[model samples]
Target: MKVSFTYDKKQVLQALRYHFLSRKEIRLMIILVNVFALGSAFLFYFKKILPLAFLVGSFLWFILMLSFWFFLPGMVYRRATTFKDHFIMTFDPDSFSVGNERGSRSYPWKAVSNFLETPHFFHLYFDSRSFFLVPKDSFSNSDEIYQMRHMLKEKIKN
Candidate 1:
């Protein structure tokens, strides 16, 4: 099967957020910060901690969220030229290939370590830090998307 598409900036940014939060370390950090912020709030309410400490905790939580939700995704989107390019992707029994105006590359099933499905894209991960997003909007119909999902499950290991 084959599909061709370009990334939507808004959707891609959301997908990037999903990818980042999916990481164990990032999720853990967010959880820890949230817990700290809640603790600070409780302590401040009961006069167990000073106002300054509570404010600091709140500020840290805000910064962490702002960085992940806006800064990192914006920075990544600007830096990666791939998201701006139109792409053609093909899937077959043995391999998959992706091509853009500049060039094309093909890889066997083993090249993909895992895949993740979000609302808008199929994130094909080569490793922990690298991946390609295939937009669901590129497919002709839901059936094609289902086929792709099934194929990825069979081709790659989680």
Candidate 2:
């Protein structure tokens, strides 16, 4: 199966947020920070701790959320040249090829470590940090989307 695609800024940013949040460590950190912040609030309310503790905890939580929601996505948007170019991607039983004006690169299915599906894209991960963002809207129709999803499930472990 094959498809052509270009990234939309809003969609890509959302996908980046999904990518970050999908990581186990990041998710755990978010949960921990939220718990700390709420715990600080409770302590302050009960007069068991200084207001400064609550303020500091809330500030830290805010900073962490801001980095994930804005700073990180902004950095990725600026650094990613691939998002500006159009791409034609073909997926076969054994491998896949991605092409743009500059050139094309192909990789065997074994090269992919896993895949993650988000609302608007399929993140084809080469490793923990390296990945290709394939927009779901690139498919011609629902059938194409289903076929690609099926193919990825069969070809990649996760």
Candidate 3:
């Protein structure tokens, strides 16, 4: 059988979280923080006229600011993600599937290693935390999603 589905970004992101956060997002955040942190360190180091206490305080303050800024944005960015369709995903029992935006990955159901579902999405994990998210919004109603959700509940726990 084939199951066709569509979803927006938030739903997809939630599904991905079960296995991994988007590398693009995490990497970009890291790069931003590192850049700022390095910049702060350099600024402080160059200010040779400053007191030793001021230098230590500046370093501590920047480190704290960097850590807080990094974590807060990640949390907020994640929690505020929207449900806009970046792609589509189709699954067939016969190892055929296609997802929009991204190219496609076709492998048998046997190739799938696990599954996870949250309140709003379905996750089919072919590897740990690496998965596709099928949003509940793709179904006609909560019941249908629940039914479909229950149907596959047994097939994956891997």
lDDT of 1 at 124: 95
Candidate ranking (TM-score, best to worst)? 1, 2, 3
For each candidate, what is the lDDT? Answer: 0.96, 0.94, 0.56
Q: Which one is best on TM-score?
A: 1
lDDT of 2 by residue, 76-144 (tens): 999989889999999988999999999999999999999988989999999999999999999989898
TM-score of each: 0.99, 0.97, 0.46
The root-mean-square deviation over C-alpha atoms between each candidate and the true structure, in angstroms, is 0.6, 0.8, 9.0
Off by over 4 Å in 1: none
Q: What digit string (tens of lDDT, one per residue) describes model 1 on residues 26-62?
A: 9999999999999999999999999999999999999
Off by over 4 Å in 3: 1-85, 101-103
Tell me how many clashing residue pairs each candidate has: 0, 1, 3
Candidate 2 stretches with Cα past 4 Å from truth are: none
Candidate 1 yields a Cα-based lDDT of: 0.96
Error of 3 at 23 (Å): 16
